[model samples]
Target: MSSSSVVAFTLGASFASIASAVVFFLRARRQVQKVRGSPDQVVEVQPPHPTWTAGQKQPNPFGHSRTVSFRSTDVVGGSCYPLVISAYIPRPIALVSTISKNGVVNMAPFSYSGAMSHDPPIIAFSVCRKPGGMKKDTLDNIEENGEMVIHIMSEWFVNAANLTCSNFPPEQDEMKTAGLTPIPSVSVLPPRCEESAVQMECKLHSKQDIKNAAGKVTATLILAEVVMWHIHEDVYDDNSGQGPTTVKHDNLHVISRLGGNTYGTTTYVYDLPRPDRPKTGRKV
Candidate 1:
């Protein structure tokens, strides 16, 4: 072959080899992902430290590490969000349900939620504004109706619940589209998810807008007063009139939110009782 033809052939061969390598790399990566994301992995719940006592040291005590800190204001909100969520470990998820004045039902989950009081049964959740400072449908519905039902997410119905997180139009009913059954709540206008093990019917007590350093409202913190509760019989433990009521963990199958697209299950649990006050301590 001529010198020019030889050069052309060499270039074509190199391009073919490069393409083949890229295809192989992509296939291998997919296989690795499938293995890591497999749902068949057996989840055996065990005590974190079976043979531990009070004031016991960690197994790898000598492997202590130095602390690294960052100034909150120094980091931007976008970067700080992932860092805080990941470092905060597992947080409880609130699958809040609300209905607009036009009767459009909405459902979505939020990780920034928790119970604040027990006497009046107050709970709070914070909803961050979207890009361009736009309010989400959930926040708008709650502000319009002042009623919501917070449900505890469970393992069985988590897939369906996740589907409701999509940014659907306000005219769409997320509960129906996600294939979840909604039942009328006794004390609230918003419906409750039938699949949830624990549901709290609450009315908006008050709301506070959170501002950033730039004096712009970044989110809204809503405080809701639960007027009624709907607990599934399988997860409820009346204690037969003997002790305080509780929930069955195994039956409840409660799942919590982790950083990114991960979730945590309550497979392993350990109890630690509070120590009695020292007898030598001064009493008022």
Candidate 2:
């Protein structure tokens, strides 16, 4: 029809819609009040659940004697025996890499690699103090040069990673003895391992001293920013049909720390996404 007639009809419809929206808003507000902590009714909200853990507190079965002398040095560096801590430890994807500072190179595996934050690409790990508990060369390189290259362990490279756990003087290159090839790092002084399936170079953002029950700084928890990552073509699906085809978890043959000197691997594995839980519930 006529333009004026159409305009009048549109205005009427807009007013009706506005009135309906206002009525809906008022009803929703009243309903929200009615359910606000009504004991008879419960709002079901599936909150985020932990993937790894929500901070662990494991009592060490392998801890020091109740002797209460307090100084581990007074007893033995062999350790108080079995630490209850092993039960809570996770199966880590070890990173075996060679790091350097002022020409001094250190090779080590860090089981503590974990995604602490995703936005800025932060990874965190606890660098245990050297047995007899000294700061390791890896830590020194990261602290002295403020850079580190982390390599992924695999079936082909785990043997070398095992060899790296040995305590050797700083002068000797562990990578050579471990049977690993030294490759150049993208953003650090240390060389990444060409033999490793994957690698990431990181820059130090912050590190804090970790003290024992005796208040001695025996370890350091390091938080670093991943500046670059080098994933081997064989490990990921590039869809170009040019990379290594299959990688069995068994083939990777990872080594893990068990109680005492015992090491373990993936004899069996199962995967399931973590279940969601209520964040605010008391769980009574």
Candidate 3:
């Protein structure tokens, strides 16, 4: 489309969305007024999103600049926190690291982990270092050994997952500190969680390093090949009878970090489906 057409289309969409929002607000005014308004007045408010700074590699608002990937300093400084919450506002995925009985160790939860390939079966998560600091144990164990098990934290395990974030010595296990059971896995030395409903045992594939403001290593992009998967049968779908895939909402509410001690969770959700619109441009 031409520039003028593009601008027109964008403005049209914006106005249409605003109109729809206003209609919904009017319809729900009665309900909203009950909790947040005077007996005769209605109130409407929109929650804030974590906005992006220039470092997140996001498209320039003016369409003139390049993308910028967010760094720890960006998150710490709140310049890119809106983007952190923005990225996680969708389905929140949990990152769990496990170590073996001998001496291996792992690190904390990062929401950026997910499956990339199904044929060879791969999983990925970006492990961030202290802005100018060394690699965390999660990446350390992956380099030393060749395997790890990333577990998903359902609502039940969200508290346990948060417990893993404490500042512990490299020798101390987050599992012990969190009071979770470390169950053995079939293909990896690192044990899986006895509590987690879903677990993927994987071997290292590749590492892509991210740079900090000082040109030092900021994060390591870790990709692993899924060798095995463990799931709790009871919570899974009857057809699959393997994992927690059947959980819709009540069983799988989530909590995630913001910048510091502050965090958020999806205690409630609402659906607003598309409305049917009357056709235009008729001869009549």
Q: Residue 156 in model 2: shift from native, Å?
A: 2.4
Candidate 3 lDDT at 43 equals 32
Candidate 2 local accuracy as lDDT? Answer: 0.64
* Model 3 lDDT per residue over 1-284, tens place: 89999999977766654555555556455445444433222233342112423353332223233235434442432235455656564434546675644575554687666678777878888877854477777777777887888877765666777778776768888886787788888987888888787778888888889775567776788888888877676544543554333434334334555544455554433443223533321111
lDDT of candidate 2 over 194-239, digit per residue (tens): 8876677888889999776677887788887889878665554443
lDDT measured at residue 144 in model 1 versus the true structure, 0 to 100: 95
Q: Which ten residues in a row have the lowest lDDT in candidate 1?
A: 57-66
Better of 1 and 3 by lDDT: 1
Please report the candidate that would top TM-score against the real structure. Answer: 1
Please state the error at residue 210 of candidate 3 in Å: 1.2
lDDT of 1 by residue, 1-284 (tens): 99999999977766554555555556545544544554433233333444556774332222222243323446654437887788787889889999999999999998888889887889999998988899999999998989999999998899999899898999999999999999999888989999999999999999999988788888999999999989999889977866566777767778888899999876434344345755333222
At residue 42, candidate 3 shows an lDDT of 20
List the candidates' TM-scores in order: 0.75, 0.59, 0.62
How does candidate 1 score on lDDT? Answer: 0.81
**Clashing residue pairs found in predicted model 2:** 60-84, 61-84, 62-82, 62-83, 62-84
TM-score of predicted model 3?
0.62
Displacement of residue 99 (Cα, Å) in model 3 is 2.4
Considering lDDT, which of the candidate structures 1 and 2 is the better prediction for this target?
1
**Candidate 2 TM-score versus the reference:** 0.59
**What lDDT is reached at residue 71 by model 3?**
41
